[model samples]
Target: MGIPGGSAPSTRLLLLPGTLGAGLIGLSLWLGLSHGTPLRCFSGVAVGLCFVSAGIAAWRLRPRSRTGPWMALLGLVVLTSHLNDGLMLPTSMSGRELITLFGTPANWLQVPVAELLFLAYPSGRLRTTAERRLVTGAFALGAVAAMVMLATKTPVPICGGWCGPSPLQLVADPQLYLRLRSVFMTGTVVLAAAALALLIRRGIRSTPRQRRLLRLITLAAGLTVLLFAATQLFIVAVYTGRTGITPTVFLFETLTSWLAAITLPLAFLAGLLRQRLAFASVGTLVGRLEHVAANTVEAALAETLRDPTLRVAFPTEQGWIDVSGHLFHPPSDGSQLLTPLGDPPVAVLVHDPSLSEDRQLLDAAATAVRLSLENARLHAQVQAQLTEVRASRQRIATAADTERQRLERDLHDGAQQRLLGIGLTLGLLRNRVRGTTGRRLVDELERELCTAIGELRDLAHGIRPAVLTDQGLAPALAGLARRSGICVHLDVQVTERLDPLVEITAYYVVSEALQNIVKHADRADACVRAVHRAGWLVVEISDEGPGGATTASSSGLSGLADRVTAVGGQLQITSPPCGGTHLRAELPCA
Candidate 1:
């Protein structure tokens, strides 16, 4: 298979092999008919058709592949060998002369073809320099041996089968060249055997992709090798002048040769057709347009190209995006292929560069999902924008939380302490100012100072809530329940400390939900329930009052939604008309 489909030669050159095969077949059949042997005639036609069909199939499958020509050569050469075999039973003096002239020369056809089949089996070339050189030398040597046989007009001895006489001698000393025939035949057979073995070994060590291509061809080639081995054994027997191995073995070997010959070409043709199977999904893909997914084009392209690693990138305003709507980029390296979708190219598929030659499949894949791909592209753009917005909101929330914590700390350690000191000073001065006229004024001023301090402490607590930091979520939640206006039934089922952010999110969800309930639920009664279950922190704040709570524009619930979203948590409010609001929030802790 030395590059089964090589650089395509001239059109005529490509068609020549098929033409030669047809002529050879027709000639062989005519000769068989003249000889009046129906079995021989049918055998010739069948073998001829096998090789010719294989050549045509390979050529059509991959016109540029040299394997097709090699396949054709295989068929044509087999025809030569078969014709030589048939010519032994001559119908004319000319036929006898042709047998004498062409018999041994035609037999040598198998030698180089066998080695060629081994070295370049299905769709590959001779892998190693040494094997290539050996096969070339065998061909050259076989040609020289044929030249010698023709020059001396020497008749090769029958191994196990009969050979007609060669009365026409071009040279006086035919025996001189005849001695060298056995030596050349043996060398050629040995080389063929070595080449075949090496081919098998290479196949065993080849890449899985290459081996997959070998599935059919390997079986056919293996049988052909066995046939050759049997022929070699027959030659060895004849050399020693022993009656060949049992008649059953000889018969089986000969019949096996015919079977192997028939199967090999057909197997190669099958191998060639396998490449086309990659495009079989074209119809299925086109049909899938009715129900195209975001990855329908990509998935279809990947399968059709037989490249599971195939990627489909949709070009966007923000560069490129993947199916998941994540920001993506075409490969910076030249290894990737960028195929734009339409004229105003909404998307481009980044794929392996090796698949560029498979233009038909790629084009079909791109076209198949153009509509869905555009929609998916738009969806991906929206996703990317959402991703950026979410990130921005998360940053804002984090900064807000940091500021709130700073304010809480300042109130607890700085302002709260100073206020306590002023109140203490007022208490100390109260006894001194007890009898003065200014004492009444001092007492009222002290009372106002205490109220101001109380309000300031409440303001700081509202900002960050010191309890949330000093204590944990459940206790802070319990404190919130105690402080709430309405009667709150608090149920805490947390057995483990949740992630800090998750706990914070859950705290805020409950805090805001309850506050909403107090403000808008026309609060008759309220329930604050927080629990840790199944890898999530679940917080529920339900109120038994008029519900109808909509997450109104920039309202309390909307702010809570942003906070919940920032922490990858969810806030769900189930408020029926004039019934009650059941606010549920879930935060993933693990």
Candidate 2:
């Protein structure tokens, strides 16, 4: 019978290995308990169970990783090593043949497979060509040694110096077998030591986060190498007649094997559990973020992730900015990573590169805070838009001032100069004309031309005054006082030049107020006061008039108010019935 979906087939395929591993472990246990020592059997069982359980959990957590499957294979290899152990053969003929043919050689694969398992830890693949070649050579050497033992050695012990002799042993010479065993054990020791050294180097060079994850596994690998080395040395001593295999020695060997087996898988599981706990903290972060404010979201995320240097920045029309709406530039030293939070990205997370090792954790944390980030992004974008609008208004005001200055320059330099030249020509003609009537006509024409020139100069000054642009606001205010038709008392305190836009805006405030006084104040005496204080230009115009004037009532005052605001300033007017009118304008100088 088949399962329901396409995934079912793969799921079932994964289940096959789990089932086979369990059965082999069961068989190993039954054989060890019935024919060998019970403590040794339980220790071997514990080792197999640890590898199988850790492998399955790791596989489920990281489905794409090969580390899980390799670990499971290590468990199977350990379990199968003890399946054929016993001093006596099975009563059945077929069972004896099967043990000699397959089970005897399968036991030899455990050492090389275990070494390869450590070499592929965490990532599940050898990182370098040297590592790959080392593991490949170990497998090949182990296979050759297994085959040689079956062909030429007799009375061969399997299952790490317990169990029984090889039923497939062909040659009768025990000395020949000892020499072969020595070579194989020496090779095993060298390979195990190399793998252990590589693991130590990895620990020393790892980042803090990486070290935390690998600490237990590294300890297990180091201990396994020591036990294997000691076991090999003892075997060599026995073969050289320096020692004999007493019951105490046998027990020590059994204990060493069991300890090595159990320690490795338990350490691996412990490391994996630590990593799982790190991932689980993402759930806690979600709960904490339920009530977080938009501005404080960055701090909350950093605290939860345990990365104090973590920063969240949102993308705006004006470029990248932080939660507080200030411009942000990511680091250039490559110490940090940028993870975009959404499609087209609402925000970017700048964090330590170590966090990149677990992309899933980073992604989960980002997902948990995505809504807060979106809100923050929208707020930043709105602020940027307001800033842009203000800048545009200022640009328009500056352009209008520039155009007014141009018109003033054209009138002064073009039409007024031509009219003066005409007057000079008329004077020359009056001298040339001897006729009395002709001279009188020439004088009359000259007088009319002078009047037109004076009118044109006044028009140019009204547009944009040359005195305000050249001399500054004090001279400009003096000019305004003299030009006014009503009695004016002007008090000028601004000595230094201000921004051109500010000066122009201030001049208009006084000019427009004086016009209102002339039209509505019944010729009341006006006081125009200008002062500079605290990076601002303050200009006040007041008149003792029977007044009820305001910016809303007068079109000129309305326009003047707008002009002040364009330069990021304010205009206020206060007028009461039969009382004095006070107009104040505050313009920023900076």
Candidate 3:
């Protein structure tokens, strides 16, 4: 506060503004009473209180804001000048002369203070170079004009006190004083207006929290300017002998000017106090969260934290979802902060970005908001089950494959071999028999053995083909085509082997389509196509038949769809009345 790049306050202790304010008040009263000067002691205290309140808040809430002490200093300047105005004590000539110039120059100090308060406002630094330059220019013009007015007697009143002899009159000229006063007044008004405009502009552009801070100061500054303008107009009208300007109206306007001046510090203090209380009340908010409804948590958070943009979201098995159970994926934008409540983030709170740094507040609030966690835990359970379900499906597929392999092996090893041996034994016995009835019985037994062996081979192939295991998908698909009752044209472009699961799915896709076509399409010729493109193994089956086909909920096709989905793939069937039925499937390999 002492200088632009001054070190931040090291301690939260802020009795300085208070001490200075009390001293100023006591001095103002003593001077007003002892020297028979007009007393405005209460107004002085209000102005001083404005400074002290803001100063204390700024120092105590240093991490949150840095604009407080500046307010206090500006108050100090006004208080000292006010005391100087009514002090009629007999003192050193130079001291009295200094006070004479002090009034205008002191008020001039307010030009920069007002400019800075607006330029920095909630923050201590200017938002841009243009604003910094604006403050600089306003300070320069105000300083130079104050110097010019002090040095010479101008029509423009520089001192509010009665006793004054200009110390710089030997080197000063009235014409130059008048000219400088005009420039000063005009420039100060123009620059002050510009600063106010900037504050309003920034407020409009800010987020909800930032704009909240701006609103009070904007109102204060706006009223102060209006009162000043009214006072100036009334003064000009009186001095120019305008008859409509009455003393009562002039007094009213002058009093209103001070009110405007004091409003800024008061408004700022009120806002800071409210914010301080809000953060301190986090414990109370914990109880509120417990009783609050599902949709009301965000509003409660906004009220408790003084941030209206707060949002509560829960994590799902699929992704993140908001309170209404709609999917939400936060983007790379940095305007909002996301605070996670648990590992893998069961729940998340999205709020004003700067609030993220208030880790203690956020952590406590998240813990306190147990109701949201209850909902989050439910979602978490769902997510866990979804993961387990996918794993179970994979295990089920592997088990089905293993069972098919076992059955195929049993057919070959246990049943087929035994049947072949029995057939051979019957043929040898038929050659040895002399009687016609006995020989015919042996031949019939051999024929029955042959028929049983043929049936077992077909059944084994249906379970899991030996051709598929030995030759791969292309040839296996060709085998399925030959075995199908209806005419089929099989097309397979993948020369290299895919994963075991992919091959099995592709094989069965052809097998199932052919079976469906033969059974339902009534001898319609079918085209079965398998191709690997862009990290996907795609299978498509088309048939020219009277069609009204769909992936029915209870059909084998529904099970196939679930199987494809389990493997991170998809199945779709297309059929319409009089249109050919087309079944398409895609399984991801990458």
Candidate 4:
């Protein structure tokens, strides 16, 4: 059977049966005025119309299910049966005979129609072989009985003691007809009991959600069977002269049977609407999931499904784990259900077993959960890649710093010492020569050697500051400030030593910012400040230079920014349109 919220049914298809049933109801009501009391006529009409309306709705709700057609058919049969009895008012013999031929069969049709409807409650299909066989037998029996009654039965009494003879009676034995009527009535009661038993068994075996949906329809069926059996037994008692059955008892039984009939269709409709509403909540669930975070999807699903114990887990190499990567043990005691969220089962949702009955809801939730899991997995992968890239860059920067220090040491020790020795040799040659031309050449050579040595010292210091290695950040920054041609202000508030990489990154940030200020700001005095806050070393450098400095425009600042990022730090340059440039670097110190 098609589930609730299946494809939309055609309006014209539904209206066809609706129009036919309504016309039959109207015809029955018009005939009822002449044949029965106003209350009795209206009650019967109400029962038939209820069935018709509910049938149309059921048809629209689940077009694939035959339950709607059966219910609508039963209502038409009921309305036609009433019309059959009313046709006795026709005085013409031929007209009466025609009504007898068609109406006799129509009255018997009610039994099999009701039986088929009962067997097909909720889903509209005869689910088992036994149910199918029972319905088939009921139709066979009803057809045979209807044909026999048409051949042997004399006439049936309508309301107000009016009667008409059956022109097609083949047998004149009234006793045989009476006996056969008793048997047919007994068989109907038996069929009702059997149908009741099947419904009861289905209820017992159903899950919680199924039970809820079946509750109303099941109750209506039970009451219908009980009333039908009581009415049949009462009629038998009256025929056999077994007891004094008062008019009051007969009237009450008739009214109760009609009430039960009316409730049957209403109950079916109620159950169908309940199922529709349940699926509607799944739409609400999808909306909720859209805004829900990946880690909290479990809680959102549980709330929407009304299963407080719901859990979402994914299959990992280590075993089953939750969204947060905590080890999870799937329930195995049969108390809960485990629903896979993907075709190949990317994740599993462990929840109340009742939810399994509503596959539409489960499928909708699964699609959302699977998407969420995939998104979270992708996000984690991206973060992992970024972390690895940052670590690699930090390692490369550390190695390059080590090489720079080695080069500085080589220049200071090897090249500077050789040049100083040459300068001393030139000085001794100048004193020994004493001749004017020789002394002049020796002095000029010594002077050239001194200038080369001074330039070498500056080169060594620029490559890697020895002061930065020996005296830490504060003293090195102070010496840098003293060396700058422009005025400089330095402030360092760090009392504890930091990681070597953090210290080096902070030193470069200051050195680079100062160089940019001196080169680009045209002798602007700069301020450099360093403070350690909450495990982070924050360094700020500001210069009174023309603003509009961007990393994209400055290769030096761009490289400096990359260095900060490599050490898992942030670099921000704020150079406004008309004034000073502010550069800030926040590096992890711990």
Give candidate 1 regions above 4 Å deviation: 1-11, 23-45, 64-66, 80-158, 161-244, 247-310, 316-318, 329-346, 351-357, 367-376, 417-461, 465-501, 519-538, 566-570, 586-590
lDDT of 3: 0.70
Query: Candidate 2 residues 35-144, lDDT tens each?
Result: 55676667666767777776765565555456667777767766665555422334343354455556656667777777777777666777667778889988988899
Local distance difference test scores for all models: 0.69, 0.76, 0.70, 0.75
Top lDDT hit: 2
Model 2, which residues run further than 4 Å from truth?
A: 1-11, 60-62, 85-97, 128-130, 156-173, 247-257, 290-299, 306-338, 350-360, 376-590
Please identify which of the two predictions, 3 or 4, would achieve the higher TM-score against the true structure.
Answer: 3
What's the CA error at residue 574 for candidate 3, in Å? 24
Q: What is the C-alpha RMSD of each candidate to the true structure, in Å?
A: 7.4, 10.6, 12.7, 16.4
Q: Please give the lDDT score at residue 77 for candidate 4.
A: 72
lDDT for 403 in candidate 4 is 91
Residue 238, candidate 4: C-alpha displacement in angstroms = 2.3
The TM-score measured for candidate 2 stands at: 0.56
Q: Residue 160 deviation, candidate 1, in Å? A: 2.7
lDDT of 3 by residue, 1-590 (tens): 22112245555346667677778777667666655344455565566566666666555555455567777777777777665543443344335666556666776777687678766866566877778889989878877876776666433333334535455654445446545555566667778788888888877877888777777888877776666556555544544446354566535544653664566656656655654576567778876766776656667777777787787777766777666555667755876888888786768888886465355567766777765666545654555566667768877887888788888999999999999888888878987999999988887888888889999999998888887877888889987888787788878998887777778877877777777777777879999899998999999999988778777732878777887877778898888878978989998877
Per-model TM-score, in order, reads: 0.66, 0.56, 0.55, 0.54
Please state the error at residue 203 of candidate 3 in Å: 1.7
Which is the winner by lDDT between candidate 2 and candidate 4? 2
Is candidate 1 or 3 superior in TM-score?
1
